[model samples]
Target: MTEKQVIYLDFKASKILLDGDFNAKLSDCGLAKLGPTNGNSHVTTSIIGTYGYVAPEYVATGDLYVKSDVYSFGVCCLNY
Candidate 1:
């Protein structure tokens, strides 16, 4: 995903799944950004995203850091 900023604000089973080779792939990139990586976090005032998928810190402090995604991914992994 070169020149793209794809943050999985909505990470669910249907959005991420195993391919033919059993390789995980992301789909339905509804909020993908067209740019390269430059920072470790994204900022947002108004809260958005799925109920449990969104990180707690993000909701509390509005800091959309990479760790937040990790927490979201962990939620997916556990649910899956």
Candidate 2:
């Protein structure tokens, strides 16, 4: 985001798909927040997303950082 805050994106593999051109597409999940965060983070309460797809740190604690979304994306990519 434009401001200083962390985003915890729950990237569902069902929402992502490769087109005929083989380009990564968001499908129907809409555009995800993509930009530089300048090393910012945020925390949340409770778990509202996929369990194992999220980072372990976030699973143990509610502290969600920018890298948490990256970790989720990587996990989805690995499963892809």
| Per-model TM against the reference | 0.68, 0.60
Query: Could you tell me which residue pairs clash in candidate 2?
Result: none
Minimal lDDT window, size 10, model 1: 32-41
Q: Mark the regions of model 2 whose C-alpha exceeds 4 Å error after superposition.
A: 1-8, 17-23, 27-40
| Residue 22 alpha-carbon offset, candidate 2, angstroms | 5.5
Q: Give the winner by TM-score.
A: 1
Candidate 2: residue 18 lDDT (0-100): 94
Model 1: per-residue Cα lDDT at residue 23 = 98
lDDT of 2 by residue, 1-80 (tens): 25644353577687678999998776543323343344545555565567777778878886666677788788878886
Give the clash count for each candidate: 0, 0
Model 1, 1-80: lDDT tens digits are 54555556666776877879999988877754332246635645456778898889878986565445678778878985
* Candidate 1 residue 76 C-alpha distance from true site, Å: 1.5
Most lDDT-accurate candidate = 1
